[model samples]
Target: MSIKKLQIPTYLSALSVMIFIIVLTFFLIVGKSLLIPLFLGGFFAILFTPFSNWMESKKVPKILSSVISLLCMALIVGGLLSFIVGNVASFTSDFDDVTSKINTYAQRIDEWTQSTFKMDYEIRNKANPDYLKRVLKENSSNISDFAMKTVGSLSGLVLIPVFMFFFLLYRHHLTQMMIMIYRDRDPNLVKMRITSLRKVILHYIVGVGKVMIILAILNISAYSALGIKHAIFFGVLGALLNIIPYVGPFFGVLLPVIYSFLTKDSLFYPVAVIVCYQIIQMIEGNFLTPKIVGGNVNLNAFITFLGLLIGGTIWGVAGMILVIPAMAILREIFDLSNTTKPFAYLMGEEKEKTQKNEKPEADNESSE
Candidate 1:
């Protein structure tokens, strides 16, 4: 007689998966302090892989090659960083003007509030013209606090370069480890996924970097023509923020417009800045990004926006920045198996692209 198989209830299995996801999310939120640097290092490690390979092709030692790769990365990063810092220092040299203007605005707001709401004399009297200056001076210590809370604030960050070094050094071994984790599956298939993952990640990072450089140059030129103070600083900063996808460019332009509104005599400068930024953004969205990045990530707009919101909520700006690559990598993983193929579809633009392709085919067939 054939033995009856033990069948699990479908609802139970679904519930188990739900519980697993919740538990996993909790752990991710809690463990981000440790995970953030490691994740960053792993990605940067992937980015530097080609450079390290090139070094190895020249008969360089593996460890030495990794070191050389890190050095190269450091030099490029340092050059850009130094430029930003120099511009920032120049910008801050005019801090008193900006601060004084802001103080004037704040005092006006306070007076308006006092009149509009009819607050007690105590509250009204509390509004000193010098209150803003006093608060800024008193809270000078808060600058350190703010820095300490920044994305790279954690002490674990020091290990990022270390992590990158070891990761690059043992890149092959890590790939092998990933393969071994799925050793039950076809090794070749697993290896293909790994290779694709690395390629997609590297392409995305490099493409984004190239786009940022282009944007920065374009922005600096435009801002200089408009005579925007701190042109270099704002230009580079806005470019840095463009890594966050859609929302970043908005805030990037908003700052300069607000400053111009407050500082400049005529409203023309602020209005011109807005018009110029919108024109640049139009070109960037329509031509530059598509031509450069070429939909390698292949994410859908709805999902991308949702990911930005969820990422920003969870880990702030760093999350927003990292979520794109993270989702792309996850899609690669999901694509590895038949069971997960639906998830891969959910994450990718394959269906949408297919629909578009079919429309033209249908038109041609009807015409024929």
Candidate 2:
């Protein structure tokens, strides 16, 4: 008996795959509104499942239990938003002081410009005194369009909780449906696959949450020690933004640094803010993430950065938030197939020498 190779001819297969990808991308873009909400709903549903299950085990009705679990999630999100808004409102209440600081900074900049460039700052200002006003007047329609888009985005936020509630209510049915779809595979293997996927998604989300909380505490302590006002607000906001990975830490630090400079008499305070955040971020990147998140997602730096860029391009902030989990899901799918396992290996982190040698070394020791 002869074994048959499973290879398809290159060009025809490649063309078919390319066409499929194009159609998939088209639908993704066109159906983003419907899809984005569903994805977010699925995400929160997974997070809230344990609470709902516990309530059920205690003989609570499913609908009521789901409502209670959802309320818990809402309160947590609402508390964070309220904290941020309160701090911002307090800062804004001192508007006059902020304007005075801005004026002082502008005057210093003008003076430096005059001395360094041998130009009269007043003459340059006179040349463009109405330039900003003229530009704003011309772009009034664009401003209106942006405002409209923002309002639309906010309204979409309402649908998320509704979707999440339903997802939680029907989670058991959904799990069974997924298993049914894989009925062609071995029953035990399909069950194992579903279980593994659930565990990976839940573990990744929980681990990331733990890391964020730890960072928030560290950030708050550092800011308080530096005498920054509204330390908790800045720290929490920064920690939340840090979820975006590489670009996020820089932006997280930038907000506090700017606030310190604008609100303080000395430039040194802003510098201190930057230095403090950098140290915390360094520790977070090297220690906290590895220990907490471990190798759950196992994606490499290049792939991660590339995912961020593509995600940002496609769906803005929502894409960036959802992309890592999407990658994890894709990696798991790829690993399940012998033909696609190589792709999964590529998505994973580069192999460390010690890890690569461990199996061989163990075998050698055993033989000895």
Query: Which segments of model 2 are wrong by more than 4 Å?
Result: 1-8, 110-155, 352-354, 358-368
lDDT of 1 by residue, 210-321 (tens): 8899989988898999998888878887888899988899888987887686677667998998998998889889998889998789898988999999888777776788
Pairs in steric clash, model 2: none
Worst 10 residues of 1 by lDDT: 140-149
Alpha-carbon shift of residue 184 in model 1 (angstroms): 4.0
Q: How many times do residue backbones clash in model 1?
A: 0
The window of 10 residues in a row where model 2 has the poorest summed lDDT is 143-152
Those runs of model 1 whose alpha carbons end farther than 4 Å from true positions after fitting are: 1-6, 95-148, 350-368
Candidate 1 lDDT for residue 11: 100
Q: Clashing pairs in model 1?
A: none
